[model samples]
Structure formats: structure tokens, C-alpha cells
Target: MDVIGTSGLTKRFGRVTAVDHVDLRVPAGARFGLLGPNGSGKTTLVRMLLGLVHPTSGSVELLGRAMPRHGAEVLPRVGALVEGPSAWPHLSGPANLRLLDAAGPGGRRRDRRRRVQDALERVGLGGIDRRPVRAYSLGMRQRLGIAAALLRAPELLLLDEPTNGLDPRGIGEVRDLLIALNEAGTTVVLSSHLLTEVEALCTRVGVMDGGQLVLTEDLDVLRAPTGHVLVRTPDPAAVVPLLDGQVVGRSGDALVVRGDDAAALNARLVAAGVAVSELALQRRTLEQVVLGLTGTGSDRVDGGTT
Candidate 1:
């Protein structure tokens, strides 16, 4: 089942459209990445899906039920860390977990405590229960936010920039934890501006720009076309006739060919008797394609629907 689905979902704040005709689907046990820059409506879409914000004209379904009207039924099964860390400054970590658990669907305190401890351990926050939230670092706060999201043992998890302020080690720790959760049959939908992080973690990605979902493509499909055959010849001037398509770059003995059909090019190189040393497939970054789809380097459209 699709853990989260939206069709023509839109949200307007006064005259400005915060979310415009967005459509998304997050499958079960998948790390679906939402990619966009600031003010691109990623946060608005998250809010609408979580029932914290209402759409002007569209529908959203979470856990197979239409939202807001069925929000009560769906929310209990969802775990979210949207926007930022929200915890009482004076409350200890464990106490905060207990409070959130009390408000959760489950009523058993003992079970909730066990779940809280497990979640804390899962995020590498074990044995830090007595520390006050005010004393915790930004990375710690992020971990706590994730732990709180797991309080209900939710089927779907929504995270917005879950690694916003983490160091290298912290980021890796969180990434591993998320992978473990997905392996255990949890659906995760996360929005991030960091393309490298998404590339490493998500199986599929939905790129949004100016409040519209511009593209949805499998990660592997997006990355495959990016690999190009790079070549370097001792005589840069002699390589042009050996290649098809525009040459991307040339630096002394190096040249970058933009296509994958290197066999024909290689034959031409041999025929020309040009000494070739470095020739390999270069991995292309999907950042440019993603940026182009969102109108990042292009003209913007007004009141557009995706």
C-alpha cells in the first residue's frame, strides 16, 4: 500500500501559494526523498499531509484514508519530525518521551517506556535520560526529535531536514538509524536540501520547485545517465575527430566526453594513432538535472500546477 499519497494538493496563504498542485506517493518500506530549496514549498506540503495545514483545492490521503476528516485515524499511525525540535526546555529527555507517549494512542506506560528507551538507543542517545533538553546540543535535539517520532511505533515517518545541524559522525549515525527503521518495515518520507545526502539514502526522489512537484524518478534511473566516458590523450587537438557530441572540458592531457558510446570513439582514437592513457566512465551528478527541473537556473512560472 502507498503509505502516503497526494493528488493535486495545494495550499495558499493569502495571495501567495505555498503549495501548488503537488502530487506525491510514498510506498511502504521506502526512503522517499523530497528535494528542493528554501521557499520551494516542501515544508508546506509536509504540513498539509500531517493535517497541520489545509489545502485550498485538492486531496491528501495518509495510511489509505482522506486527511483532516480522517486525520485522527491516520495520525496515530504516523511518526513525524517536521519543522524543528519541539520539547520543553526544562523537561528531561525521558520525561518528554513519557509525556508524548501518554498522548499517543497506546495507553500502557511500561510498554511506552520500553519503546522510548529502544528509540533512544536506536538513535545513539542511550543513557542520557536525566539530561535536560535545554542542555542538549543541536545534534542531540535532532535525535530526540526522531525518538519522539517513533513514540507511537508508527507505520509512516515524516522528517524535514533531519540532519540539518549534525556533524559528520552524527549524520552517519542518523542515516544508519533510518536505514534500520526502513528495514524493519517503516515507510519514511523526508525532505532535504542536501542532494548528496538524498543520493546516498533515498531509493526514489521527488523534486519540487516553486511549490510544484516537477519530477519523480527512481534514484538509480536518475544516476545511470549521468555516467559519462572520460578520456585523456597526450595530444588534446587530436581527440576531437575521435569523439561525437560536444566535448565538456579539456585540460592539457585530459578531455571529458559527454556520451557513453565509447566503443566507436575508441575505434576512431586507434585509427588516428593518438596515444590514449586515461579512459573511464565518469559518474555524473544529478544535481544539475534536479536544479533545472525546479527552475533554479531558469525563468520562474506563476501560479503553475504540476
Candidate 2:
């Protein structure tokens, strides 16, 4: 079943269109990643999905219910941590979660406390509940935010840049936690600037650019070889014509051919008296694929607004 769906999902702010005629679908239990450069309307689209923002046109559905109209019904099953962590600095970790749980729709006080403690344990923050929010490290704060989102045992978790300001170990911790949550049957929709993190954790990926969704596909397909072969020869100029129109371009001293059969290309090169040195299949990385799709040509793996 599709846990999240959108059609012609457009959002406009004043004269600018933040999201434009976009369509999206995320299957139940999927670890889905939404990727884009800054200002590409990723946040706006997410807001619309969560019924936090009104769309200028089109529609949104979450967990099988139409959004805005059924927000109350749908939202109870969803949890979100957008922007970054927020907590009462003077409050202990457990205390802060107690307040949030009290405000949420959870059951009795005892049930709320048990749920909060379970959430803390799930996020690896149980032992440090007594630590003041001001005393916790950035990673601890992020985990606390996650624990708060998990307090109600939500079916769908919407996290935007969940690892924005952490060290390498902290990043790995969060990554593993998300994987465990998805494995435990929680549908996750993650938006982040970290491409490697997305590539590692997401089962499916969607790319947005200029407020439009340019491409969405399975990670396996996105990471597959692009039917291109990188051939290093003594004379690229001599092999160029022999390759017919299969030659894409040259990178450094290698000729890039847009063909599946590297053996055939190498045979032809040899028949043409061109000494072949190296011939290797070229597979596109998630970063490369996204950059090509967005046309940003940026090496930095960060999201931005349009």
C-alpha cells in the first residue's frame, strides 16, 4: 500500500511557486529519501504532505487519508522532526519528553511515562534522561528529538536533516537507528543534505530541482551501470571514429563509449590497430546521478531552497 501519495502537488508563496505540479508515492514500510538542492521546494512539499502547509493546487494523501481534510485522523499516525532539535534547555531529557507526551494524544500519565522511557531506550538515550538539555551533546539532542517523535509509536516518520550538526560517529548512530526503525516496520521519509547517508539508507529516492520532481526511482536502478565504458587507449583520436557514434566523450586520456559491450568495443579498437590499455565499465554514483538530474554541477551534498 502507498503510505504517502501526491498529485499535481503545487505550492505557491506570493509570486513564487515553491512546488510545481509534482507527483510522489512512497510505499508502506519504505525507507524513502527526498533529495534536492536548497530552495527546490522539498520542505514545502513535505509541509504540504504533513498538512502543515496549504497547497496552492493539487492534492496530498498520507497513510491512506486525504490531507488537510483528514489531517487530525492522519496526523496521529505520523511523526515529524523538521529543521532541527528543540527542547527546554533547563529541562532534563526525560522531563522534556514528558511535556511533549502530555501535550500529544497518548493515553494516561503512566502510559505516557512508559512510552517516553521506551522511546528514550529505543534511541539510545535512556541512561542519560537525567542530563539537562543544555548539557547534552548535539548528537544527544538529535536523538532526543527522535525519541519525542517516536513517543506515540508513529507509523510514519518524517525527518528533515535529522543529522544536521553531528560528528561522524553521531551520523553513523543516527543512520543505524533509522535503519532499525524501518526494519521494525516504520515507513520513513527522510530529507537531508547528506547524499551518502541517503544513498546508504534509502530503498527509494526522489530528486527535485527548481520546485519540480525530476526523477524518482529505486536505489538499485539509480546506482546501476549507465551503459557506458571507459576505455584507455594509446590513441583516443584513432579509436574515436572506429567507435561510430557510441563515443560519449573523453575524460583525461580515456574514451567514454555509450555501449554495453566493452569486449566488442575493445575488439574493434584492436582491429583498428589502436593499443587498448584499460577498459572498465562506468557505474553512476547516486551523487553523479542527482547532480546530472538537477544540473547544479555542485559537488557539495547539501539541500537548498529555490
Candidate 3:
């Protein structure tokens, strides 16, 4: 079953349409990534799904229940960490989690302490239980926020830029944790400006542009080779004609051919007396795909619901 589904989902702030008429579905056990540059409406869409923002038009169903109407029933089963972490500076990490957990649903008096400690340990923040939150690093705070989200052992985790402020180590920690969670049957929907992070962690990806979902597909398919072959020969001028119209362009000392049969192309190159030095297929990276889809190199989208 689809853990999250929306139809004709849209949100407009006066003259600005933050989220366009978008239809989205996230199947159970999917490590889905929602990617877009600034103002592409990723955050707005997440908000609508969580019932944090009322959509201007359309319907939403999360965990098979209608949104807003059944949000109280459904949201308890979902965890979210959006717009960075917020905690009481004077309070210790464990204390902050205890407070947040108490306020959240499904925590019983007998299990609150043990649940909070387990969450802290899960996020790698258990060692600093006595330290004030103000002394914790940005990454620690982010992890604490994640622990808070996990306190209820949610089935779906909606994380927006969960690795935003972390160092390389912190980013790796979060990445590994999310991967482990997904492997254990939790569906994760990650929204982030980091395309590389999405590429590494998510099995499926959705690209948004101008507040519209431009593309959505499996990550492997999206990054698959485009059947374009790159050939490097001693004589580029001599090999150009042998490829017929398959020549896409020339890259410095090589010829780019749009063909699937690499062996045939190689044979033709050799038959034509073109000394082939290299024959390689070209593949597009996730970054390249995103750039081509958005037409803008901007990595981040600011303001407006994010």
C-alpha cells in the first residue's frame, strides 16, 4: 500500500503558488527522495502531507487515512524532522527528548524514560546526556531532533534536509542511520538540496521545478547510461564518417556516438583504420540530470514553507 498519497495537491500564498497541482505517491518501504531547487515547492508539499499546511485544493491520504480529518490518528505513526532542530539550550539532550516525548503521542509514564534513552543511544547522543544542549554541536542537535522523531517508533519518517548543518562525519552518521532504518522496514521521505546525498541514500527520486513535479523514477533508471558511446581514436577526422549520423559531438580528443551496439561501433572504427585508444559509454550523474531538468544550477531553494 502507498504510505502517502496526494491528488491535485496545491498551496498558494496570495499571489505565489508554493505548491502546484501535484499528485504524489510514496509506496511502503520506499526510500524516496524529494529533490528541487529553491522555490520548487518541496517543503510545501511535505507540509501538506503532514497536515501542517492546509492545501488550497485537492486531497491527501497518509497511511490510508484522509489528511487533516484523520491527521491526529495517522500522524502519531509518522515521524518528521523539518526546518532544522529546535531545543531548549539550557536543557540537556536527554532532558529535551524526555520533554518532547511526553508532549508527543503514545508515550506512557512507565516507558518514557527507557524510550528516551533508547532514542538517544540510537542517534549516538547517549554519551553526552549530562551536557547542556547549548554545548552540543550542530550535528548533535540534528541527531537529537531525529531521536525525538523516532521516540514513537514510527513507520514513516519525513525528514527535510536532515543532514543540512552536519560535518562530513555527522552527515555520514545520519546517512547510515537512515539506511539502517529503511532496511528495517521504515519508509523514509527525504527532502534535501544535496543531490549526492539523495543519490546515495534513496532508491527512488522525484524532481520538482517551478512548483511542479517534473520527473519521478527509480534512481538507478534515472542514472542509467544514455546509450551514448565515447570513443577516443588517434585520428578523429578519419572516424567521423564511419559513425554515420550517430556522432553526437566531439569532446576534445574523442568522438561521442549515440549508439547502443558498442561492439559494432568499435568494429567499424577498427575497420575504417581508425586506431581506437578508448571506447567508453557515457552515463549521466544525478547532478547532471537535476541540472538538465531544472535548467538552473542552483542547489537550494529558500523561504516559502521550507
Candidate 4:
């Protein structure tokens, strides 16, 4: 069964339709990633799923239960750390978790406390679980937010920019934590604008553009095409004419080439007496493909719009 499913999910904010007839399915135990620019409806969609926002039209189902009507049933089994950490600034880390556990449904015992301790240790905050949240670093606070979410022992976890304020080490720690969670049979849906981070962590990605889901595919399919090689030569002017591919860009003495075959170009460069210092495959980035698709490039959707 799909952990989360939405069909014809639509949401409108007065004049703007934030999400339009979007369809999505997150397989159980899958590390699904949502990608888009600001105001592209990623957060809006998540809000609707979490029952924080009402949809203008359409339907949503989570874990085989219809949403809004069944949200009460579904939410209890799910955990989330959305946007930013929401713990009380004055409360100690463990105290905040204890309060959340006490308030949640069926969470009335020492087992919840033990789970909180386990979560703190899992997120690398075991040593300072007694410290006040206000005194914690940005990364520590982020970890605490994660620990609070895990206190419920949820089957589905939703994380939105969970790495927002973290340093490099913290980011890696969170990434590894999510990966481990998924491996242990927890379904994860993470939303972020960081292409490299999504590429590294997500198995499948859904790309949103102008409030619409433009593309959804596996990570391997989204990788940039490897059709050419980058070459750094002593003299670019001498080698430009002899090269078969188009010169895409110039960085210092290096030239970015795009073509069907680069082996012939390399052989030609050697025969032409051009001393090549570096030769490497030029891979397109997710940003390049997304920019091209969103009409952010020179090529406009209609005639002469830009």
C-alpha cells in the first residue's frame, strides 16, 4: 500500500492556485523528495497533506485512509518537522519532548520517556538532553526538532528543510539519520530546494514548477546527460575550429564542449598540436535542466515574451 497518495489535489489562495490537479504516490518505505523553487506549492501541498490547509478541490489519501475526514486517525501515526524547529525556547530539550508525549494520544507512561531518550541519543543529543533549547546551537536545535518528531514512533515521517540551519556536519548527520530511518521501514517524504542534497538522498524526486508537478522520475533518470567532455588547453583559439562539438562555456583556459562523441575531438586536439592539460566528462546539473524547463532560460514559452 502507498504510504501517501494524492489525486487531482488542488488548492487555491484567492487568485492563485497553489496546487493544480497534482497526482502523487509515495510507496511505503520509499525516500520520496519534493523539489521546486520558492512559491512553487511544495509547502502548500505538504500543508494540505498534514491537514493544516484546506484544498480548494480534489482528494487526498494517506496510508489507505482518506484525508481531512481521516486526518485524525492518520496524524497520530505520522511525525513531522516542518519549516523550522517549533520547540519552546525556554524549555529544556527533554522537557519539551516529555510535554509533547504527554499531550499526544495514548502516550501516558515511562515508555514515552524512554523513547524520548532513545530519540535524543539517535539524533546525537543524548549528552545535552537536559539543556535549555535557547542555549543550543542551530544544528543542535534542528536535531532536537527531529527527536521530538520521532518520540511518537511514527511510521511516516515528513521533513521540510530539516537541514535548514545546519552546518556541513549536521547536514550529513541528518541525511544519514533519514536514510537509516527509511532502511528500518519508515516512509519519508522530504521537501527541499537544494538540488545536490536531494540528488544525494532521494531515490525518487517530484519536480514542481509554477504550482504544477512538471516531472516525477527516479534519480538515475534525472541525472544530467553525459554527451561531451570538458577540455583545458593552452590555446582555445587554435582548437575551436578543429573541435566537432559546440563550445558551451569558457572557464579560464578550459572549454566546455557538448556533442555526440568526444573521443574524436580528443584525437583531433592531439593531432592539431594543442597541449591539453585536462579532459573530463561534462555532466549537466539538475539546476540546468529545471531552469530550461521552467522558461527561465532565453527560450520563452511563447513568442518574444522575455
**TM-score per model over all chains:** 0.87, 0.81, 0.86, 0.82
- Candidate 4 C-alpha error for residue 131, in Å: 3.6
What's the true lDDT of residue 292 in model 4?
Answer: 60
Q: Please, what are the lDDT tens digits per residue for candidate 3 over residues 217-264?
A: 999898788899998877888877776788889967788999877888
Error of 2 at 197 (Å): 0.9
Candidate 1 per-residue lDDT, tens place, 26-65, comes to 8888899999877889999999999999899999999899
Quality of model 4 by C-alpha lDDT = 0.84
- Candidates' C-alpha lDDT: 0.85, 0.87, 0.88, 0.84
Task: Report lDDT (Cα) of residue 84, candidate 1.
Answer: 87
Candidate 2 ranges beyond 4 A from true positions = 229-280, 295-306
Pairs of colliding residues, candidate 1? none
Answer with 1 or 2, whichever has the higher TM-score: 1
Considering TM-score, which of the candidate structures 1 and 3 is the better prediction for this target? 1
True-structure lDDT of candidate 3: 0.88
What is the TM-score (0 to 1) of candidate 4?
0.82
lDDT of 2 at 52: 85
